[model samples]
Target: MTLRLAGGIDVGSCTTKSVIVDDGGNILGSHVLYSGTDFEGASDIAWRETLSLAGVSSTDSICVFSTGYGRNSVSFATNSLTEISCHARGCLHYFSGPMTIVDIGGQDNKIIKLDQKGLRVSFKMNRKCAAGTGAFLEEMALRLRLPLEKLNDLAKQADGEVTLGSYCTVFSGTEVLEKIKSGAALDHIVRGLFHSVVKRILEMDTFTDTVVMTGGVIEHNPFLIDLLKTHIQNDIVTPPHPQIMGALGAALYALQEAPHNMD
Candidate 1:
C-alpha cells in the first residue's frame, strides 16, 4: 500500500509556513521561513523543505491546502481556506470544548471564539494598526538597536514597571525613545511593550474559560502567554507547534477533503 500524506501551506504577509501530516492527524514535518517579497517563492520553498523533512519525494502524490494572508498566491494549493477558519480548526485540534483563540500574526491579530462543538461563534480582527502585532515588536526592536529575537529575553528580565501610552506603532516607538532618554530600564520597556500587546488583544474581545494562543509571535515570545495569564483569570494555553497552527489546520483539511488514492 502507498503511504498517504496531506500538506498545508500558509503564505503569511511576513512569513510562510508549511506542514505535512498523515491520515491519523500526526504532524510529520513542518517548516517556517520569511515570506519576503515573493509569496509564491516563499510558499514553494516552505513546502519543499517540509516535504524533505518528512522524507517524502517531490514526486509523491499529496493534497495541499493553503491559508493565510497570501493564501491565494499558493499556485499549488488544491484548495484554500480563510485564516480565521484555519486558526480555529488548528486550535481545536489540540484543545477540545469551547475556547478563545488569540493569533498574533506579523501584520495583524485575530480573536476567534469557538463553541463547545468546536464551531466558530464569532471573531474579531485587528488590521488597521500594527501596535499589537509582531511588526510592532520588530519596529521597536529596531528603534532600540536590539535584535528582534532578543526582545523576549529582555522582556523576561524586566525588574521595573513601565507603561506605553500610545496604541499607534509610530507614537509608541517615539515613546520608547523618550523612555530611553529618561533612563528607564530596557528590560522594563520591553516588558511594557509585551504588556501593551496583551492589553490590545484583551480590549478586542472578552475571553472564555480557556484561551489558546497561536501564531509565530506567541511561539517565539512565550513570555506573552505568561503576561496574559497575569491579566486574565481564564486558563491560558498554547498548542504544540503554535506557530504552524494555520498550516496544520490546512493540512488536516487537505486530509479530510482529498480522496484516499492519489496514484
Candidate 2:
C-alpha cells in the first residue's frame, strides 16, 4: 500500500521545525533544529530529516508547505503560508473551537484569536523588542548564572515575590542584578521573571474565552503556564506537541492543497 504524505517546515528566529502528516492529518514524524544564521540551511536540514524519518522520499510527489519568519526562503516548498495563520490553524486542531493563542517564541511573542469557524478574528505581535521572549529568559538565566534548563525548577521554589519592573532585555538583566545585590533569593528572582513574561502577554490585549499557549518557550517553561493561569484566573490549554504546532498546521495545509485532496 502507498502512503500519502504531507510536510511542513517552520523556520523561526531561533529554531526550525518540520512535521509530516498522513492523509488524515495524523503526524507521522517531526524534527527540530536551531535556525542559527543559516535560515535556508536549517530549513533544509529539518525538511529532509523529517521526511527521511517518515520513510517518505524527496523524489516522491509529496506536498510540502513552509511557514514562519523564513517561510519565503524555503525555495523548494510547494507553497508558503504566514506563521500567524498556520499557528491559529494548528491550535484549532487541538482545541477544536474559537480560542486565543499566545505563541512565545525566541525573538517575538504573538497574540492571536480564532473564531468558532477557525477564521482569524484578530492578532497582535511583539517583534520590536526582546522583552518577554525566549531570548529575554535566556538573558535573565545568564545574569543569574543559572543554566537555562534550571529556570523552571528554580521558579517552582520561589520564597517570595520579586517583580521585575523593566521589560527591556538589557534593562531586565540590570534589574535582576540589582535584585541579587539587594539579597533577593535566586528562586524569587526567577519566579518574578516568569511573572514578567505573563505580564507582558497580558499587556498585549485581553484575550477572550479559552486561551491556548503554544511555541518553544511555552513548551520549555511549564512554570509560565501556571503563572499565566494564576494571573488570568482561568485554566489554559496546550497541545501535546506545542513546539511544533506551526509545522503541524503547515502540514495540514499541505494536505488540503495536494492535488488528490483538493475538491
Candidate 3:
C-alpha cells in the first residue's frame, strides 16, 4: 500500500504536539509529548512518534511543517509558521464562522479573532507573566501539593466560587497558601485558580461571536470551558484535537502550500 502523508510538529514551552494527515485532511496519527527544555528533541520525538503511530517512516512523508515557539528548531520541516497563524488556521477548520480563539498554552495565552470569511481581524496575547497560562496552574498545583492533572476534578468539588484577586503567579501562590491557612476548601481554592485564569484571559481583549478554546490547558482541564461559558453568553466550541490544533494546521499548510512533487 502507498501513503501520501503530511506532518506537523509544534514545540510549545510545556508540551509538544505532532499530527499526520492524509491528502483528504483526515488525521492518520498524532502524538503529544512534554517539551521540557530541549525543543529539538521534542520536535524529533513528536515527528517520529506520530509517524510510528501511523505505521510509516520518513520515506512516506510528503512534507512536514513546524509551528509553535520552537518551529525553527524542527530541522526536518519543509517550512515553518507562527502559532498565531497556525492556531487561527487550525481552529477555522472546525468552525469556519466568526469566532474568537482562546488558546491557553504552557507559558503564554493568545486570543485570536477571525471573521466569517476566515480572515484574522484582531489578536491579543499574554506573554509577560505566567498569570493566565498553564504555568500558573502548575505552580498552584505544586503549592497545593496536588498534581496538575487533578485541578479539574478538584475544582468540581466546590459549591461556591472563590475569586482569586492576584494575577501574579508568585502572589497567587502566596494567596493560595493564605487561603489554606484560613481553612478554605481545597476545591474552592482550586476553582478560584481556574476562575483567575479565565478572568485574566477575558481581561486581555474584547471577544466576538462564537468563542473557541484550544491548547494543552483546555485539553487537560475541560472544566475551564464550563467556567468560561459562565462568563460569555456566546456558545463555546472546542476542536476535536485541541492540543494538536497547531500541528494539524501546520500539516494542512503543508498539504496546501507544499510542492506536490516534493518528497
Number of the top-ranking candidate, with lDDT as the measure? 1
Give the number of the best model, judged by TM-score.
1
Error of 2 at 89 (Å): 1.0
In model 1, the runs with Cα more than 4 Å from the true position are 58-60
Every model: Cα RMSD to truth: 1.2, 1.9, 1.7
Q: Write the per-residue lDDT of candidate 1 for residues 88-172, one digit (tens) a residue.
A: 8888889996999999999999999999999999999996887799999998888989988898999998886589988899999
TM-score ranking, high to low: 1, 3, 2
Q: Estimate the lDDT of model 2.
A: 0.87
Q: How many backbone clashes does candidate 2 have?
A: 0
Candidate 3 accuracy as TM-score: 0.96
Tell me which residue pairs clash in candidate 3. none
Q: Is candidate 1 or candidate 3 better by TM-score?
A: 1
Error of 2 at 92 (Å): 1.4
Q: Write the per-residue lDDT of candidate 2 for residues 11-120, one digit (tens) a residue.
A: 99989999999988888899999999888999989988887888777536688899999998887789999989898878877886678899999888999988888888
Question: Candidate 3 lDDT, tens digit per residue, 1-263?
Answer: 45567888888988889998887788999999999889998888878888889887654447889999999999889899999988988887788869999999999999999988989998888958879999999988988889888899989778976668987999988888888888888899999999999999889998789999999999999999999888889889999979888999899888886455433
Q: Positional deviation of 161 in candidate 2, in angstroms?
A: 3.1
What are the per-model numbers of colliding residue pairs? 0, 0, 0
